[model samples]
Target: LRATHPPPRPSFCWAIHRDLFHYCALNLAYMAPSAREVDMALRLGFGWSLGPFEQWQLSGWSEVAAWIEEDRRAGKTLVDLPLPDWAMDPQRQVVHTPQGSWSAARATLSPRLSPPWLKRQHFPLRLLGEGGSTAASAGRTVAESEAARLWTLDEDILILTLRTKMNILGEVALEALDQALTETEGHYRALVLWSPDPHFSAGGDLKGFIETYTRHGLTGLALAQERFQRVVQRLRCSAVPTVAALQGYALGGGCEVSLHCTRRVAYTETNLGMVEVNVGIFPGAGGLTEVARRAGLRALAAQSPLQVADYLQEDLTRILRCTVSQSAQEARSWGWLESGDVLVPHREELLHVALTQALALAESGYAPALPRLFPVGGVEGRAQMLAGLVNALQGGQISAHDFEIGRILATVACGGELPAGTLVNVDYLLGLERTHFGPLLATQKSRERIQSFLETGKAVRN
Candidate 1:
């Protein structure tokens, strides 16, 4: 007769979500004897995004469950909530499901089911002309020196995995990727960029950036940016359909890399962000440009002809704040992802879905994005953004350096002094980004922040 949980206010959803999760978790822990039943009950009853067991897996079952165990022992319990059986056993903390088993403690996903397409041939590639073999089994070699590798799936799709340290984009890795793309051209039906490494990528190597800037100064940094730009742009406009199988931390340049793909198949647990602001620089490698482009497209889609400045304010706020999407769904909300981008329920299904999507696009005759002009936010947007920055600075909410960064971002986003009616293309935004970014690399605050990050693995805000 009556609805169980009333529709919540906008501000109340977070509290409701948190409270309901805790309630369900506690009830399921003690009452329901079976893990699958508990999972099913919570998912079906409340229409939860993830069941309690899955949420437990994501939140570190062993540690959080251990806390529950200690709390139970101390009699600091809530209602009649029972402790989960698996919580009592350290070994059983890693929950098992038909799709896969994930151990939050180990950060490992061991899939019980493998996709049908993966049953085909597996090939190992040795890039950079280094062909030394050591226990080459099933075409996968254990090469210590190689930075990139390609695997042929179903003899049609070529999956390139960047194998550098932390999967960071080094010069060697970039060079190998470019060569792979060039060689695989017209040969493979589709190319999928993927890695089973803990992170899709942490981003470009900051250590490499520091080394280059220290040694070659601005000239070296400019050259490196050019190479990075060229490779990413090439990927963006590739003839063969491309898909990035993304998971874990895809931040900064890693985020940029995905922006260049024909399509992105993101794992639900992806932690995606454009975090260059943390390093005291704007996104130089087509990331900010991509964001601007997406914002422009959003404005074009609106019915009421919303001011481009309104969209710019919202989008640039995310960039300036280094907003990270904790899940695929959230990434979509942030406009980092397109409506057409695929969201894989299980991380194990990411590559398979990507491969399938790539094949479908290829079969449908994939068309690369056309070179088109976008409407820049222009003079009005720039004035509004600068005024906002000034207000924030006056309020002592941001540092002077941050204000300068915001100004640079505003200039780039609005196409740098372009008139209100002028249409700006991708090249214009990219050029503005590169021009501003190079100067930041030469700044003391940026250098200090980069150095601090390198030395202490923490951002130094000046």
Candidate 2:
């Protein structure tokens, strides 16, 4: 998967977009299914990023059709299929819209395809932000910053959508999230964190960090990261009901934000993980803290107090694995998604389901989750975790750098200098994370890892 290699086409692009355009045109030549279903089938069934019609348009339907017609004349037809009417009449309109978060005109089709739980009563899609100029036809916009927007679906539901490239959790987006949460209080009953980008988020904008760190070094990077963490903490404690509508990649900070939300309505196809380790860092933006905390809670709930340490270790190991989930169910197993959270099979209905969940919580009188003193197996636990990690490194299961990261992860999980069976708060854990994380930013190995990722899009094993 290098730039030098031939670029891979979207899945099924060759078979469906090119071959089927000529070979199976007869099936679609006379009668056409709703473009939504066709698009859904391509996306859900084959994992194609774009459907046949969209890909055809990109290649110019008229030109492709003429080529197909020429190929057919050359006896190159796979089947004697008549040319599609839409291909012949390129001006004919198709009920198609780009699959995006703000394409609410096409959102109406979602309800029909959604689950029974998504109560789509009168959810009028209204875009909120300074992008009123373009989104005016779709929905009303509220003037927020350009990178993020507040979308109102109904009187009670407010959707805070990140509009930045890849919906990266940059300064603007985080600030907008804080502002939206603050402004929507008493006015909007609930909030849904969403994005129009294919990825819910790719985590913090690495390009942003690369620039800052390259220019001003670790001091500037630390300040930027601290501000990001503050917003994440705020989201975790926001009084209003909040739901993360997640699909595609929710890595590192993206996954951390979802973990902090009141609920997560995730698409089955979500690729969620705390993937900061790939860049020689751990999940410093509340991910490590929350994963350990939530796993402890689950273990505590099961009346298996002895299993808390084991659960925490499992979570820590998963973070070190940096294993991106293949599906939402896998994400749940990874502790990135909770058991009570909703999983949507269709990506199209993810937002609707999330908004419904948010509204449900709001109607039931939503309250911020109480702060928890996570029961940790302090020094004893850290020793045991370190022993295991050391053994893994000796056994060549992980690299020396991975072992170092794991040691930091274990120390943070153990609540710093606390004794065995001690309970620690979020602030204590965050302090440990920040303290451990800061020095890594200045490490030659860390700098090399980050640079390798920025340049090659892969981790340096050393």
Candidate 3:
């Protein structure tokens, strides 16, 4: 009888894993370079998050070596090179020490010379260790939660690290931030918000929002939004200097958090934006308010009202389209990054630069910025912005929901029914955000867009 069923297919991951093992084995036998060097080459040259040797070590070196041996015996491996003795020995680690990593060629720990690696060694106390210790011993750790931690540096600087997945801003993170700010009042000279994750923060917890809305309805979502806004407001009004060390994607609430900080030190690769509109909501956490504030300041500097009008129009375009800056330079052009903000060329140098700037600010007797009235376009500005959206809607250039979002954004950005060139405080702009946010969130199309994004990670125009 002929077999009708097709044979089981090999996994792509397994094939890649096997190839990686073979490649590392060949390199170790012939090139005789340190595992760290190989890892660094792949990271710097190829932009891999993890090198072959690093991935192997992460997957358990001995276990992977044994599997390779089995494959070699079965004539399945790409190469016949024997696994290194050091790798098979469970006691010997490839990169175990802070000072250096193990080299197969030298059969010794090679000294690590990377600037970031060297800098990290200076700070011996992390609030939470690799083993997940949360003990607040010897003033090293002031506060900690599952989502975030507040730890001290060498010069009375508090480092608040968001530990959530993608460092998403949630209730736990917000609470931790509030506690960190409270602790920083008289104790720490400066505060730095940073993370070791690939992303500084992807944004607010979309999954959390879905769960909340599904189980507890709009009221629950509104309460959560309110809590987030209050915490961010406190960050803006913080007595001490707050520095944001930004890299990777700083979108939505993450961008808002950085926006409120005293100064931002960004990596050249950093991507920043107020992208909540893609998920069918506006930046309710003072993001639009900050943009409006910046636009007002720029307009004040301009010699003509035409320049002021252009600035407002540009910001309006960004808000409605959810423009995300591709690089630090672009972010600066978009006005998300300020002129005074420092841009670090190396990812490793971001925290160092940020810390230095924070210390400098503190030493220079930095004071929190006082709340002041800023110029807004007011009712005429809102109408002017809406006119373009109305055209786009009539011309079928944008969906009805897009027009609706633009309208709400226009209202918030223009300061909600005030006269042209009205001067309003930050709190008033913030209030407008909260007020308009609910209506957009309440819409069925907006909810659909949010749900689609959460499920597939793709924005739905509807």
CA lDDT of each prediction against the hidden true structure: 0.73, 0.73, 0.78
Q: lDDT per residue, candidate 1, 1-462, as tens digits?
A: 013555555325434433444465555435554444455565557765666666666656667666555555666544435554435457754465444444333334434333565443132221111233322222332122488777664778877888777789888888877876775575777888888675888888788887888899888888899888889888888888889889999998899999889899998889888888888887888988888787777677783223677887877877788888989899988877788899987665676688889899899988787887667788778899999889999999888888888999988988888865367788878778778887887799988888899889998989
- Misplaced by over 4 Å in model 1 are 1-145, 303-306
lDDT of 2 by residue, 219-320 (tens): 787787788778898887888888899988998889899889889998888999888877888888888888768766776788764456777887787788
After the best TM-score superposition of candidate 1, give how far the Cα of residue 275 lies from its true spot, in angstroms.
0.6
Query: How far off is residue 90 in model 2, in Å?
Result: 9.4
Model 1 scores worst on lDDT over the 10 consecutive residues at: 121-130
List the candidate numbers ranked by lDDT, top first: 3, 1, 2
List runs of model 2 lying over 4 Å from the truth: 1-19, 29-44, 49-58, 78-137, 210-220, 299-307
Error in Å for residue 21 of model 2: 2.6
Which pairs clash in the backbone of model 3? none
Q: What TM-score does model 2 achieve against the real structure?
A: 0.81
Q: Candidate 3's error at 159, in angstroms? A: 1.7
- Residue 43 CA error for candidate 2 (Å)? 4.9
| Rank by TM-score (best first) | 3, 2, 1
Best by lDDT: 3
